[model samples]
Target: MSDKHSPDEKDPHDPQGMRGGLTNYGDTDFSLFLRKAFIKGAGYTDDALARPVIGITNTGSAYNPCHGNAPQLLEALKRGILLAGGLPMEFPTISIHESFSQPTSMFMRNLMSMDTEEMIRAQPMDAVVLIGGCDKTVPAQLMGAASAGIPAIQLVTGSMVTGAHRGERVGACTDCRRYWGKFRAGEVTADEIVEVNDRLVPSVGTCAVMGTASTMACVAEAMGMTMPGGASPPAVSSDRMRVAEQAGAQVVEMARRRLTIDQVL
Candidate 1:
């Protein structure tokens, strides 16, 4: 009997990239051929296709203003991936926001998680960057990436700018609650309450205060799921875009080293 493995046996440690999780066609070569052919229709060259693939999730929607910076972040991420010699592919996923979701955002968290997991499993990327903000979105992405077991990392959309109302700094539901409490106690007028609504959220992005969205961002960073200082950048700041670019560059290295999700978790 031969002691060495057969040459036909696949190398489990090989970089998956565009070759990962091919569709079942009963023929590995055919499956890969079809995938490459279709992907090439998108104008990918053989040299580019040969590079490591990095997936970035697009969770931006009009209703989810917390992720309004998705387009900018995606662009920065692509720039970083290409600079680092990797292919960046952006994919869409279900996005949930506390203010917009029917009933509650929590009700839809599991569904988003399932979507994230299945998308990662079905894609051909060697590693993925989960771009999320808001309360439930980050948790959902983490849950999904954990189950997918790929080399996955996170990039938060970041917080919003603090606005001033009546010369007082205010942002998000936290300040909204405070004002509402005062309004209920007859300390603030109905007209003033209505006027302050416009100033509460002066821009698009997550809560500026230490709400669930901000909390989850920090948790992801502290848990080693994101780069240092990944949690604090405001959504509209140049720092956030830089962080996204860094995330893209970092994920390429993670793919090269096979830094699977399990390692981080």
Candidate 2:
């Protein structure tokens, strides 16, 4: 590969060995200056920038209830990063929602993956935390992280808590196929179906059962990418925030160790 930075460039603050692929072509100092200029408006101090940079990918959207807890999670994660003495920066990536996409979310997954990969490569960070809850989003992020080859850890937005319908336990789906089968068979009246629908989704989070979002969370845990018990907590639970905080701490350590994604894989 061609050199990411030109030799003999003087940048005392530059994490030279760590920050690869120049932010601005042929001028590292000016690049860092320009980058700091824009972000400084957000109140980032030089001391903060001096620490290791951990990029937190924001995959949240108003349409994605599965990732509804994203802002809270990001806050918790940032707390962990700060506690662990790292600079945490949250950046956006393509968000894929299972129900909202026009041509089916799967069709747009590849595009999301490309967006993830390109953004990761373009940004300057020692490590990254991949936040995703949707089915295709997790895999797309992983695929991108795999290609990006940076130190990364997967943090799930978490599953929704189970709800209750008319004193009976219900799930977040608000629309399971079993209920549809009952409706189609005329076993359930339209009024009852509507009533059940009203109660099924009690809160904001991913589908409760082993749907794509929850299933992928389990898959992520199985793959050794997620923290222990990362797949179990409900999205709105305090435990989920704890998991995010721990992930932030771990990613900073990963950065310190210079652990790349290939090593983790």
Candidate 3:
């Protein structure tokens, strides 16, 4: 810890030395002390923050249930990173649920990607874990990570569980559209439509379909950006949490190896 440095001795946490640009304010011992001072406000002991820093991209909000499990996922990731002798820090970027953004979610996608890339480059993490789902989040993260050139791994928030309405199996926007179509043709009553809405999304997660979110998750695995079987699981399932923890531990190894995004590509 830079907090423990003795006078007349070099501060090993210098950015050019061990911290790798994280402590780049200056090479002086007082510069290291200044960096550690404000960071201590987060209740971190010098020893904890002294370890390699792992950044977590948190793209969750109340408006986006697709990323509802982000906090749980982040906690699990932090546990594994701690066990692997690393410090995990969570930061926010723009969250884009398919139905929330105006003027088109696609229009907002490039902006989110730019936000992700800039934040990753500006932060002090040695490596990053991109946690996202929803329609645009995954690709935006990929675009950002690719440009940032940092060691990065992507984790999907997983799908929502299938719900039930009037004793029939119901999924997400797929089923939602089917029922709406019937209503539009005057074949179903307004009352039935309202009832179906309540049962469509059983839990907090992205659309439970083979749409963009799930497709990107699978693609990430195929491209070696995700762990084996990481693409398959409900967001609320224990399996998703387990995979998140594993991602955290794995990123530490990536940092140790100095595996930049170029290496993965």
Q: Which portions of model 1 miss their true places by more than 4 Å?
A: 1-15
Q: Would you list the clashing residue pairs of candidate 2?
A: none
Q: After superposing candidate 2, which stretches have Cα over 4 Å from the reference?
A: 1-20, 172-175
Per-residue C-alpha lDDT of model 3 across residues 21-111, encoded as one tens digit per residue? 4545555556656766787876888567667789899888999999999989999989888889888989999999888889899999999
Sorted by lDDT (best first), the order is: 1, 3, 2
Tens-digit per-residue lDDT, 1-265, candidate 1: 7554521235534537666888999987777779989999999887787788999999999998899989999999999999999999999999898989999999999999999999999989889999999879999999999999989989999998999998899999799999999999999999999999989998878999988889999999999999899999999999999999999999999999999989987
Top-scoring candidate (TM-score): 1
Superposed by TM-score, candidate 1 places the C-alpha of residue 171 at a distance from the truth, in angstroms, of: 0.8
Poorest stretch of ten by lDDT in candidate 2: 2-11
- Model 3 stretches with alpha carbons more than 4 Å out: 1-18, 22-31
Cα error, residue 17 of model 3, in Å, equals 9.6
Quote the positional error of residue 86 for candidate 3 in Å: 0.7
TM-score of each: 0.93, 0.89, 0.91
lDDT (10s digit) by residue, model 2, range 17-118? 224455755887676667778878889776676678899999889988878899999999999999999888889998877879987999989998899889
lDDT of candidates 1 onward, in order:
0.90, 0.83, 0.85
